[model samples]
Target: MTAAAPPRRTGPVRSEGVRLAILEATARQFAARGYDHLTIEGIAAEAAVGKQTIYRWWGSKSALVAECLVEGMLLPHRLAPPDTGDIRADLTAWVDAVLTLLAEPQGETLLRSIIAAAAENADIGRRIRESLAGSESIVGRLEASIGTAPNLTPGAPFEELSETLVGAIVLRALSRAPREPGDAARIVAAVLGPA
Candidate 1:
């Protein structure tokens, strides 16, 4: 019988390094080309890794982009939505936090890229929603803290209200309109209503 060839080695350290490099490359690509035009090969080239490596780690371009967005942009701002036993204060804080992020250049670029991606690609859109909107990770914590305020039920209406508020901020950013602090505060007040 012929001797079997040695199995390829994929050490954990190297695997993690490749993952990090891919994420960095994906960020740059997304920033430069937007999500619609980004390719796995391009990311691999930018990261100095093989396309197969990216495929093995992330499975698809959408997955990679989602991970990159979450890890780089969303995770850093992961506020649990201030409870403080006051719904208005907690929501106001949350809105302020989001508005502050929207004011930053990096935040603007990332949000635009995500919106564009979501518009043009259904898979990417779903992934974006799952990463940012669907998961109770951020909003759930906020809801728990609020503990059933007057209008803010833990239901569809509340979700829609939250979406509307955040979506307005994102739309303003995309439109190149100024995001005034007062405007964000107004949105919060409108949603929560008369603390």
Candidate 2:
């Protein structure tokens, strides 16, 4: 008797439309039920996709949700900080862009939901952090810009300074007030010291 050939199992096909649908579904899920109640099945149904498809791409619920947060809430919407070899101008522009994004009506809600999800689930928190580990995040962007700027000593307190700048922006963003004209400049000066 002839031996039968094994069936070939190709990997899952990635579709941008399906991914967008999943992301949108995740956003709706967060809006409707919050992260505490989010479920793979629920998201699958909301996205009209099979559970295996999500698993094939993201592996776990937290990973999927983390991606949703990254794609929908935290990043991808962010603009690149201009690299003008001037830390003051670059940072001011960066913070101003963030302030504008956070000023949107749903922005606060999105930020709150992600934070709440992280607080509610330690696993989700870790996954989100891990997922973001590779991100050239705000701090990384600032460090890169600082590397090109003048007046910073080698290993100057870039991490702390970036944190200070970001923290100020986040705190101000939570207030939902119109951005003061001096806000960006003030934050920049605080970090890099005077234009």
Candidate 3:
């Protein structure tokens, strides 16, 4: 039999498995070291991939971190709200979860880092908006339960209500204000009315 010539590879083969591994690794490293301390070399070692592989996919560490956040892999806690069929209770639970996260030192750092990333990059800002609107996000979860609020104030659209709650949380976190007990319930009530 005559020896056959081997086929030449045309280009880099993008592997979903490797992509996921890199994202997961980035998330782990981000959670452990925070954004300022996370290094591409460290992530590559953790994911068993080369630095070039990461560079080929993401141009910068911020871009990689943005993808991790968009994929729900980077946050310290899940951002999705509970769906208990009661909007009041659900909103309260979601708000409480967020407040609890913000109360943590690492959680505060994570939020600030995300804010800094989004502020510095338009692409990251867009990705953040996209993530918040996706089915796995808090907005999506809140939408499912919004209609069940027994005494929702008139003209209080879910968008506005959500914005109000999230805006307050962000400001509070940024300002380092102490979150008091019943804060979640009070915030929810302010937007949704007495339950």
Candidate 4:
């Protein structure tokens, strides 16, 4: 994929409204036609914005899709994780929300596309992982929220807890088992301690 160059701005830059329209259009298109059918011209037509507009904002089709997933799909989930002073409750809520999102077709489609892209492009893989895995990362957020001591332990990894959580989510997704409401609490307990 060719990296799109930003068009020279000869006038006032486009508004956020235009960028949002494009993202919405991209989501609509992705939902209607799937990821394989995404096209610059098609998105432009759907958004009623110039093709240069999109290229200026996002450098590639994958980049645009990534933004759409971030903005339209995952933004709410990202911002909604609470730090309500109770680490177990906060993590449980966050994890449950994540699981709920994954259960959606839109979330599943976006995740599957990211996985496919990551498999083909190492950069995309790393970028999406770093970007979507929480504020700095899922691990980072958990660390910030939980704040474990510098103490040492055996059989329990404090730092790499996010990887375990991610593995659990992926396994749950692939297993296609009905998720229990208490699932997140169990995960939090396993990572943190008996609640």
Using TM-score as the measure, the top candidate is 3
Q: Which ranges of candidate 2 are over 4 A from the true structure?
A: 1-21, 24-43, 49-66, 71-79, 122-135, 147-151
**For each candidate, what TM-score against the reference?**
0.63, 0.60, 0.76, 0.63
Model 1 residue runs over 4 Å out of place are 1-21, 24-47, 51-65, 71-75, 78-85, 132-138, 145-148, 154-156
2 or 4, greater by lDDT: 4
> So what's the TM-score on candidate 4?
0.63
Off by over 4 Å in 3: 1-15, 52-59, 75-77, 150-156
lDDT of 2 by residue, 135-180 (tens): 3655555556645555365776655666677668767876666778
Q: In angstroms, what RMSD does candidate 2 have relative to the true structure?
A: 7.4
Q: Would you give me the overall lDDT of model 2? A: 0.68
Task: Write one digit per residue (lDDT tens) for candidate 4, span 1-195.
Answer: 998999886965779889888989887888787766779999999899889888887767777777666553535445356776566687788888878877877556656766665666676657655654555445555656544422213433544676676768777776766888699999877767675
lDDT of each: 0.66, 0.68, 0.78, 0.69
Ranking by lDDT: 3, 4, 2, 1
Q: Give the least accurate 10-residue stretch of model 2, judged by summed lDDT.
A: 129-138
| Model 1, span 1-195: residue lDDT tens | 999999977653446777888898887877777666889989899999988778776656766766677565433444346556665666667777767776776556566656655665677776655544433443554456444456665563555666666677677777877766477567777766654
Clashing pairs in model 4, backbone N/Cα/C closer than 3 A = 133-138
What ranking emerges by TM-score with the best candidate at the front? 3, 4, 1, 2
